[model samples]
Target: MATTRVVLITGTSSGIGLAAAVAAARAGHHVVATMRDTGRADALRAAAAEAGVAERVEVARLDVTDTASVTECLDAVLARHGRLDAVVNNAGAGYVGTVEQDGLDPVRATMEVNFFGVVDVTRAALPHLRASGGRVITVTSVGGVVGQPFNEAYCAAKFAVEGFMESLAPVAASVGVHVGVVEPGAVASEFIGNQGIDLPALLDAAGPYAPALKAYVDRTLAAFGQAQTPQEAAEPIVEALTAEHPPFRVQTSDRARAFVGTKLADLDGSVVQHLTGSWVA
Candidate 1:
């Protein structure tokens, strides 16, 4: 933020991504906000305009799941900006179901978007980031630390992302690139609300998992009711970007910190099982 670096962020169509892009722009940085569909960029563009940071924000098309798309966006960013300071890997999707009911197909699909997508974007952006001695800030979830019921695929992908970044952070630091992960708890966004689920149909087809799934759904919905706004969640991301020496891992809120802390100290694993088990009870 002090130097006004050129920052590139993915998945800026809505929610935290949009808020992050706008917030970064408002901080006097050049923000290239990329999303899968540029047609859905009205909200981000409008927010930039409203914040009076429209000139600092540029919207681009990027599909993180596609290697070519990732390559093209990075290439374009360099060709236009001449240097890349930071990359925020925020593009991702969510899935809600157990492996037995969803099969391997949804699991693989979710991994493509949530896990491999982050890898693709980060891989493409690293060389440019290295040249500028920049940073890589990824938006992972608390699920990355603590597994939950009825979210096997989603948790697995986030866990993979966390592992990947944790392994890469030190190696990246050796070359002047700083890497950090932001873990957010429940965020009250369309991404949380619009999971494309049909409750009655899914429950009716759930077989023995129906009652547990129903309980999980009820608890999840209630928790999301108190979810933080996208703006509040985006604050940590900006902190990771601008802090003099950003921590490797940052939680968006105290609740998120405690949630991940529970996993960190669960040496026997019993504590986690006992805690998450009650979600489906």
Candidate 2:
């Protein structure tokens, strides 16, 4: 039997975070599933109970954007469980639109949640992780490697996370902590819907870039149609948490691997630029 790990996951209100939390619990791990607002945990709670692992899963409040909340959540976990065996940084926000259209504020906000949030949670969990030889798994995106068009802010944040984890993985290994990143392609989640972008309004406002924006939107919709469900995407994350020696990077599906592989195999920036530039043309 696999050892029971004390695992903490953020953004468990829905989607991948919720699925990961439940999957970990079903796998015999003690899961602390946290979200910014505990009131929204109904779905997660219901799922856990249905999975028959409800008792092993605890719902908590953790606002990754707030340092105090991150510290307090980790402290409570330690006090309650005495040790933390793993942490899954799954909380993230999405932003869509060209850089010029989205403005700096939106970029900063995306970074605050998608990038800085991971930094805060990881920072707070590292000491305990080091002590227990624990694992750190983060849900990044294929955009982190490929830089999708119209996702400037969101992609930038994911790219930052990829770089941060890649840089820290080796050093963390020295201290007996494992760090891994799970990259998903087009995930069927509320991330896009929650971006709060009004498609009709944004397209009408495009003016000079309307044709390009329309084409990009059409292509994105087609891709999302083939996207993996939250549970399907969460499998790799659960594996990362339980595997004896998980890889530093893992793509959730064959499509994700193919998309990210294009960037990895590119010797020059030419390939990526050509691909992304097509969206604006």
Name the best candidate (by lDDT): 1
What's each prediction's TM-score?
0.98, 0.96
- Report the Cα lDDT for residue 34, model 2: 97
- Candidate 1 off by > 4 Å: 1-4
Which digits, one per residue and each the tens of the lDDT, describe model 2 over residues 1-281? 13567999999998899999999999889999999999999999999999999999999999999999999999999898789999999999987777676569989999999999999999999999998999999999998998877788999999999999999999999999999999989889887887788999999977777888898998899989999999999999999988877899999999999888989999887998998888767
Instruction: Write one digit per residue (lDDT tens) for candidate 1, span 225-260.
Output: 889999999999999999999999999999999999
- Please estimate how well model 2 matches the true structure, expressed as its whole-model Cα lDDT: 0.91
Task: Give per-residue lDDT, candidate 2, residue 98.
Answer: 74
Candidate lDDT (C-alpha), each: 0.93, 0.91
Backbone clash tally for model 2? 0
